[model samples]
Target: MIDQTPLLDQISVPADLRTLQPGQLRQVADELRAATIRAVSQTGGHLGAGLGVVELTTALHYVFNTPDDRLIWDVGHQCYPHKILTGRRDRINTLRQAGGLSGFTKRSESEYDPFGAAHSSTSISAGLGMAVARDLAGGNNHVIAVIGDGAMSAGMAYEAMNNAGAMNSRLTVILNDNDMSIAPPTGAMSAYLSRLLSSKSYLGLREIGKHIAERFPRQFERAVEKAEEFARGFVTGGTLFEEMGFYYVGPIDGHNMDHLLPVLKNVRDAKDAGPVLIHVVTQKGKGYEPAEASADKYHGVAKFDVVTGAQHKPKPNAPAYQNIFGEVLSKLAEKDDKIVAITAAMPSGTGVNLFEKAHPERTFDVGIAEQHAVTFAAGMATEGYRPFAAIYSTFLQRGYDQVVHDVAIQKLPVRFAIDRAGYVGADGSTHCGAFDLAYLCCLPGFVVMAPSDEAELAHMVATAAAIDDCPSAIRYPRGEGTGADLPEVPKVLEIGKGRILREGKTVAILSLGTRLQDALAAADDLAARGLSATVADARFAKPVDTDLIDRLARDHDLLITVEEGSVGGFATQVLDHMTKADLLQTVKLRTLYMPDRFLDQDKPERQVADAGLDAAGIVKTALDALGIESAPDETVSGKDRPARA
Candidate 1:
């Protein structure tokens, strides 16, 4: 490996970083950026964000006593550089690997990561909470929240800012404006202005002016406040933040250490100041040529060559599930003019970009407001438009209230295209689609469907599009689909009905979502042991297929329910139906699902295997339920292999 980060090698932690002189920080930032690029090239994580904040991360740690003074990063995408500076540089290359460093900031990982986050727009709120807690505990430590421009689109950030303003707390919010690209070029004047505004002298002078104005008549005081606001607003264009009751600073250049260090030091020294918003303009992929040239700024990347910036993405044997959803939806929209697509700031991630290519007029990119996206889709649905809200399963949790109230309660035909509906590798538990089944199945008049393969996903899209009276959702996992042939024309399947794939008499496997293939594999394993197992794909999680359940219960000696979801999902629904029907009285039943505890980052296959939702797990569960012990030489190892009595 090339030793490009000579300056970075000297620093083991943020304290080590603070030991360096301010003049040496520019070299440190350059080396840190190089180290970040080198690490991400090996591990394939969020690159552009970390690259953008290399200088800011250096300045923050240098100016403030971190771990003691709480510093929170919103969504934690830009924390890779922060991680490299804060005692985790050794594990930087092991990022997103099984049992290695998490892709996002994790509290358990290090003391530097004060708040854990993967979801956006939560830093300000968490920082305010910490600040308030510090005040109550009679601690005078600083609380700083670093949030991105994209994350500011969410209502939560604004709500936190509003609260912080009202509470008059000693908090500093760093608005990292990387996306807006609205700031003029920062030079000596702008940096000087930023330093002047954030300095303690200016703050004290302003407070004295306020007190002096208060001694005069009410009209005169009001005029003085307006004059001061107008002068500052005209110069910095921070009237909105000023109106929200925060002391506003500049849109300074974030890459310049000379500019960043002084402004940050000024803010840190302002102990008696209320909540302050420092607008720092940054460019995503600032130091990386390949990322800067790309349209999405290489926001998310795969393992790549450091010399060429060419990603080593595996060639898909079949179409990706996300692309299939997009193509199928676009095709449906061609025939039906009322079909519209909406996505909350994840057009490409959710495959809405494909939809936008064909039907540009009908597609809506609703920023990072999932709740607004949900309600907006409902509004379109009310106007007789078949609005498809394509969102990640984890992100849909942010808009559950809108899903329940605006769509489910009103019975609107908003088709929810839930992408990434299972264990997502690398992104970890925060992005896992584990609870969608549990949350959506509980809703009244909801048609929920999970596809087993690519063909099935296409068909389910048609199924959800066909449903007009009530809300419908079709969930599919991330990555490439199984090599199933796509139908020339997608056909709508019968709602609340399941199809039996194989027949047997000894045991039955009722599978939901992508676990159907695992169920079939388990059946094959059982067959090798002289056992016959029936495999059925329970397509609908909400509507329990009683007829199929009854037949499986009556025919098989052991019946098992399997799904790629949490405990209270498809398995719970099936068990609830079985209990009400008294089918549990005669037949032996078992359930295979994700464990109760939150799982950490790992490969998707490894995560499934660990959770006991794989084929081997199903086979073991079946054998254990039937009171038939496996031999010591069995394929599923590391278990107590008891001899048969």
Candidate 2:
């Protein structure tokens, strides 16, 4: 356990911290590291990344005029330390909780957090935009974008760099190279170059050249510039940033304050330097013993013992949805030699690592490049291989254009296993998988599916494996399965079909995804109120289960569709089919979907209830639609009967 320090107790915000001497900043960094560890041990959030950037975070705030000078953290996993320094230390323990601070950076959270970020590789673009805006407004405040080495792999970062170079925007990009991005980095040469370029002589000569260039004309400095570029290219491997038209600087030691403060001051003070890149190499989980040893496992953790570093995760009765998918996919791959699995730097998170263990040759862990991962899978599909491109639904949004252009347009047979397909808990609005169904179902020649339980997930996996003509997707939510027994031999579900779970009259409750459980609970609530309700699981979001939908519409007076996704998803598809079939004339329709608003971090149960997808909420919706007022004391299990007149 770390002891309370007088220095940290005195500092409430960065302004207070700025009054301290440069030598004293190290002490602040140490106390900040201890405080961050203690806070996350209580809150259970992104621990490793924040630990890695402690010195960098401290140095940035101390050097720059924050809140005025825009500082954007890429992916925002490393923002906990930033949050601690920026007047949020008092509420740091409330991170990722209901009515507390968010896990990621939010613009609404603080003025210091100029731009919000939860996704990877977006910092450069957002920071460049702020810098341009500042220039247009005639504001002289500096703009800095601190991004990870892993984030640089995405094409978006390069695109922003290209544009910033051309526009000659006065922006600073600090590359936080930790050599670990959820997984070990794929491109080692880029990592090596970052280390090699941090030499003292190289940085000194570069700084001298910058000063000279600012004072002199382009005509006189041409010969000297060619020599410097050649020397840099020959010895240190001229960074790709330089070729794109930005001034490149150091691969400094991020943990060393002496090195960081001076270099940062030089970069910040440099006049007319357009878009500088400072590559700083640091270790993930730098301070904590347990985290530094096993960085990946400690990246995201539940509450843990401060001394032992033992996380307090409760044992689950059933396997997680991710593990179930991996286990089933591994079994299928044993029989089918053509089966291959791909993940974009999230092998363990997506459960592709389990598949990799069985067939290392067939499993591909493409580094943080989602766009490249999608197209690479398309190429493999063209060669007659069954490729399972398992990615989180939120992360898949990054590769939507590729999904449409490469796979859908060409009719490739890439099986997309979209994990985390609904309201994911503590990660909040940014990580919620609410748009997959709406986006994928709109594309032609695609088969989209969502399972109600783990058993059904196995069946869908088999179904997706069998799809060889067109692209197919199976989306599942995060967390443990529904305690359903796994079949010895998984069955392949019929394409575009749904199954009825319960038969009734008057009202038919249709569920598209994992909300089937809630739908059934809502049925019980309706039944107790003397209203018979039918429950059906519309397994596939696309292909609408036309026959089952028609049966329900014809027999029932009211049809209420429930889904875990946002609007324009399963409910909209059902409504579209009903309108075309002219069933709206007879059946009254109501759709219960996620509200058109971004919900903050909380428990999954709370998120569901807030979204009105829970039993009580659904019951209330049905009662309101039927023009029946629900009694406050009514029971859902039919135990307490209301006297019928």
Candidate 3:
């Protein structure tokens, strides 16, 4: 080992970096980059985006006084470099580990992550808001929002831009146009940015215009500068942002601190109280060959070999839940004329690439526009086309209003194939599918289902299209199934019903989704402890499977509910139903669910353990609630079961 500790050893905080002379900034940048690579290699998190922003991160902290001059990063996946330099160097190795720093920016994590982000296109809006607040409070501190080019494609980004431009808040919006956000970002905003950058006079004229404006007296200078902003549009390819009233700076080379430092210094030092947009273009995975070629591969990865750039081998056999959804949806689309697929700029990430290829005409990528996708699907549904809006459960949070107002209120049959439903390993709280259940369950006439296996996901897709009365959604996890055998053909599962996977005695446990296998293991443990447990895959989290609940509560000793979602989710729904039926006092109850906190980053299993959702946790809870203690040979295995007394 060459011991990278020396490079990482020196960095404790941004204040430490300030101790170095101006010439030493690049040296510190190199050290931060190396430390980031070393740390992320061990932890296996957002490598490419972090790697790409190394110099930019170094330069921002170098030029601007951070924690004071709020530096807000969009999506926060690229915050690793920022985290490393901001006194968190030592905790880098535990990047996404339990109780460690979050992979995304968190308000509570550190002061460095001023405006926390997990979803895309939120930085400019958040930063502008902070800038306005700062002005109201009479604070002189600068506010800078760094957003990716991909994030700009989102309508909210434009909405924020349009408003910020008009308000002329003393804010700096750094557009890190790397042309990628997990995957290649699409839409017209991308093209507009490209054209703005391609204009030869864009940067030069903007600078020249600034000098001329500065030459005149204050009031005349302000009006003249405003006119130049209009004239510069001709020079800078129509300048949409300038028209919106922002002083557009550059589509400068982001990695080049030679370019970055001067521009940042100019922006920071300037008295321009109006919004200043600094468009910096950087390469995704800059300096890292493996990630440079394939940014998506390194976006949010597992432990990988640094030397060969190969991801650590997972157990072979079962397909990931995402892959299953993608493959099955594509195949089904081939057979059904009405079945079309849609993903919001996440073609490959959501496994809609298969659907894109299979049904090329039917496939539509809305480009970071989740709200539009929902409404678009609704329009398609009205035209007699079955649109499957394949979106991640977390990202769908952005489209809640659309789901309720556009889809559910009107009862449009838009099949939502929600991927990454449960505890995603590396991405942490921002990306966790924690709130989907509560949001989805609240909608009337919406048929929502989650599969206990990969096989059931395929069936749910078929079932969603078959229903024309109301909207339907099926949520699944990010990883592989439990190697459960697949059926030869898919079948439509009955809406609002559940399947009994295993039979037990006193305690009945409702497995919300794929957690059924683990529930089975826990049931075996319960039986061994002489507290017989029944396992049932509730299938539908929305409808609550009232029949299953009523029967189980009537027959079993205690009723237990388990789901990999936040509180006010599946268990809460169950409680509401049980209360509605006046069965609250009729049954002893327990619920194994995620807590009411922003559970930080960790592996899926570790998070489950941390949240008390593991097999041992389940067993302990069941034992405690049932008033059973001091059992014998009480280990839960996948295969064997104890005698069911």
Best by TM-score: 1
Cα lDDT tens digits, model 2, 154-184, are 9999999999999998999998989843222
Whole-model lDDT, candidate 3?
Answer: 0.80
Question: Where is model 3 more than 4 Å wrong at Cα?
Answer: 1-11, 19-21, 180-231, 295-297, 584-586, 632-645
Residue 333 Cα positional deviation in candidate 2, in Å, after optimal superposition? 0.9
In Å, residue 283's CA in model 2 sits off its true spot by: 0.9
Model 2 vs. true fold: TM: 0.92
lDDT of 1 by residue, 195-240 (tens): 9998888989989998999999999999999998999888888899
TM-score of each: 0.96, 0.92, 0.88
Residue lDDT tens for model 3, 1-645: 123445446668887776666777776777777777777878888888888888899889988898898999999999998998887877878887877888888888899889888899999889988988998998999988988877778899999989998887788888787875322323334334434433445545656767887888888778876676566555444377777767765556666666677667766766653787776777877876788788473776668777777878667678887777878877777678998889998888788887777778988998899999999999999999999999999999899899999999999999999988989877777788988888898888988898989788888888987888799999888878877676667898888989887777677888888778778888887777766778899999888788899988876767889898878778987899899998767778898888888767777998887777878878888878856676846543222443323
**Backbone clashes, each candidate:** 0, 0, 2
Worst 10 residues of 1 by lDDT: 636-645
Could you tell which candidate, 1 or 2, scores higher by TM-score?
1
Residue 506 of model 1 has an lDDT of 78
Decoy 1 TM-score against native: 0.96
Q: Which runs of model 1 end up more than 4 angstroms from their true locations?
A: 631-645
- For model 1, state the Cα shift of residue 145 in Å: 0.4
